[model samples]
Target chain A: MNFLEEVILKEGQALSDQVLKVDSFLNHQIDPQVMQKVGQEFARLYRSEGITKVLTIESSGIAPSVMAGLELGVPVVFARKRKSLTQNGDLLTAKVYSFTKEEENEISVSKKWLKAGEKVLVIDDFLAHGEAALGLANLVEEAGAEVAGFGIVIEKSFQSGREKLLKKGYRVESLARVASLSNGSITFTRNGQEAWSL
Target chain B: MNFLEEVILKEGQALSDQVLKVDSFLNHQIDPQVMQKVGQEFARLYRSEGITKVLTIESSGIAPSVMAGLELGVPVVFARKRKSLTQNGDLLTAKVYSFTKEEENEISVSKKWLKAGEKVLVIDDFLAHGEAALGLANLVEEAGAEVAGFGIVIEKSFQSGREKLLKKGYRVESLARVASLSNGSITFTRNGQEAWSL
Candidate 1:
């Protein structure tokens, strides 16, 4: 978490009051070594829950999910936003409302990919409004699977995402939680039990 | 390669005359162990080529790119299809035509993440019409970077993707190349010297 926080501080760019662009190492352009460490950290954190699959959305979440999947020796399944010709009709679909994109898009996963009673851990790059996570959780539940927990790389604690997921009684773990991004400065919540100190 | 071939034969579904769906393990739901082997194979194949970065386009390409990046110990940069609110204006953009979706979309990579003169190896899940690869290659070139090679999980030999890439003088390596898909039977091109025998 320290490494991730350091990387965010060093490479993440701020684009106004709400957006922090981590294209350098976290999302668009990825640092594999750092990603591997993050994966190992997630695996260490959630290894005891008996996670059967790692679920994520398309694009940004694929890298970390793949990394965590490798460490956990589980399969990684991603929900596709766009329906391609290769995609079949046998799918579990969920409608995700993106606050940023300002649109509601249907994301789906093949029912053949997710079993009926598997334990799934959801992973993603950023947890802002928690819409994507909730959507993914919906897909998992649609398959009659259990939500073991949620793992995120960077989280905006000031947002309602954490509160929303916690309201649903889902255990969420994030590597770096930004307590506040006031005046273009990032303040990360102290990880571990010290998170209570914030 | 044998493992990948076997996976394709077992789990891959023939959606139509041209589309082969391997979402069970290659794209939608990925087998981490097999993905690690794929990364290792890519690393072994391109280790001597001095690859500085792994380049790919999201969302399907992110898995194999991360795998290959883990093996090569290099960073992975994925081109995003749409401009998100989090993305900044500093980007290298290109137009890509999606045959499956039947649409044309713009893919972009942040300028801050990709540097000039980096040796990049492009990776993807499928090589059908080669538009995505060509779009990624265009982005790399726009960044003033050199493409070391292209690695694909599966390539439909019946399609013109390989020929188009070969015409561009790119060294392409596909783990499983389907010669033809007829009556739900798949034929793989022999490895080694016979691969080019086509």
Candidate 2:
């Protein structure tokens, strides 16, 4: 198992078959060491892609994405989540629905930050319904930039998020692929084999 | 001049006498290099404080605080901003009024993340009217923890934020202290002297 999977198994709470709470180390309370290592992992994976910038949503995605940007020696641009439309007209906006929050927020990136023909690497903490990932990709495309790939921390392979992104022809790399979270137990896929339960 | 001040002069916008826009490097579009340096400076300033954790507000504060936590070998916890009180009754909440947005947000920290007698270094991107800093300190105190000090990225010294924090006996260290933003130019405080102007 990777370091991330080991950490998840040790501290992650399998709240339900659909919800996995990693508040202790990932989202609410952040483990900087874990984030640093995760950043290094992302840099290792996408170093050859000629990524110009790292894009992520605000709040949860900032930590890992900034660390990855630091490792890759690129700037990090976070899309701000606004409940309403901002007054700025020079913004690349997308509508992202949060399955956990059950709300749709307008995520926006400033036009001045992103340039045309730039290769952007998108990063996020989780991949569930892929709404956020799709929204981020939409913003990059709107800026006339290329979405190089996505670096996700956790992927619920049981969900259709990963499949949807793959079908869209975007390279998605998730460090921890969760196979199951049932009966308060967590399981992972081995060597990209989803059928290998636990 | 410090590196942060240099970057501010180069890329930051002096929107008005009171408003400084650092979206290009510090907030919306983050320069990972500058953030890394800022984190190191924060760690250097507070390394002797015996801080067990780094606490900051979400979104803008995550990048610098997480980097400082990594340098100090501690966990970084971010308080989540909610439009209203959350359903969880175990959170330590504080009321913060934003001058720029003209909104009152109740920032909450989970009770499980903080422990009694632990020293927390409060981190924030901007120290203005001191509402956010005081609210962060209130959250730490509510958890029975001690607020070791405040690590701020930018401080508008003309505002009452730093004075209030100091009056409350909190050590406030800002990497870049802005004395004025008048006439589309930015000035800084030199050697703790606020009289130095551009």
Candidate 3:
């Protein structure tokens, strides 16, 4: 988490009060070394939970989820944004609004991949309004799978994402929680604290 | 390579003449152990290239590229198909035609991530028509970077992807090359040889 926070502090570019661009090492361009460290942290956090699979959305979430899956020795399943020709008809689909793209899109996974009573840990790069996370959780429930928890690289605590997931009684663990972004400066929550500190 | 060939022989699903779905381990649902093996194989193949970075496109390509990057102790850079509002303006962009989607879409990478004179190895899940590979290659070249070679998990040699990349003078290495898919049977090309035998 320290490595990730450090990387964010060093390389993360804040576009607005809400969005932070980590293309250098987090999403677009990835740092495998740092990613491994983050994966180890996730594995340490949820190893005892008996996670059967790691679930994520396309594009950004794939790298971190792959690393976590490798560390946890589990399968990684990603929900595709667009329905491909290869995708089977039996799928669990959910429509989610993307604040970044300013549009709504559907994410789906084959019913064959997820089954009943499986434990799935949802992972992603960023958590803002929590639409993507909720959508993934909805898919897991649709498959009759258990939501072990949600793991995120960064969370904007100033937003209502954390509150929304917590309201649903889903445990959300974010490596770095940004309490506030004022005047282009990011303030992170104190380490190992339930409530974010500004 | 034998391991990969065995995997294809055992788990590959042939839908038609043009489609072979291995989403169980290669793309949609990723097997961590097998993915690690793939990373090791790629490391073995390109270890001597002094690869500074592993380049790939988003969604499917991120997993293998991350694995390969981890094995080789290098960073991975994935080109994103959709540009977020936070994305930096200075980017290397290329137009890619997706046969599956039946449309042309643009992929881009922030110029800040790819430095001039960096040695990059492009990795992908499938190489059907070589548009994605060529698009990635174009982005790397535009950034004044050196492409070490291209690594593909599966290449449909029956298609023109390999021929196209070869004509561009790229040294392409595929773990499993399907020489043909006929009558619901898939044939793999022999390893490390230009001449493919079913």
lDDT of 1 by residue, A43-118 (tens): 8889999999999888788778888999998999998885332445688888788888788888898898787789
Ranked by lDDT, the better of candidates 2 and 3 is 2
Q: Is the docking of candidate 2 incorrect, acceptable, medium or high quality?
A: high
**In candidate 1 chain B, where is summed lDDT lowest over 10 consecutive residues?**
B189-198
Give the true-contact fraction for every prediction, in order. Answer: 0.93, 0.96, 0.91
Give the per-residue lDDT of model 3 (tens digit) for A1-198: 366777888988787788788887887788888777777778888999999999999888887888899899999999989632344579898889888778888899989889999999999998999999999999999999999999998999888888999999999989899877777887788556742221
DockQ: which candidate is best? 2
Two-chain complex of model 2, DockQ on C-alpha atoms against the true structure: 0.88
Who is ahead in DockQ, 1 or 3? 3
Q: Which candidate ranks first by TM-score, i.e. highest?
A: 2
The C-alpha RMSD in Å for every predicted model, in order, reads: 3.6, 2.9, 3.5
Per-residue lDDT tens digits for candidate 2, residues A89-193, read 899899998888888899999999988999999999999989999999999999999999999999987898999999999999898999899999999876644
The CAPRI class of candidate 3 is medium
lDDT of 2 at B50: 97
Tens digit of per-residue lDDT, candidate 3, span B103-158? 88888888977889999999999999999999999999999999999999899988
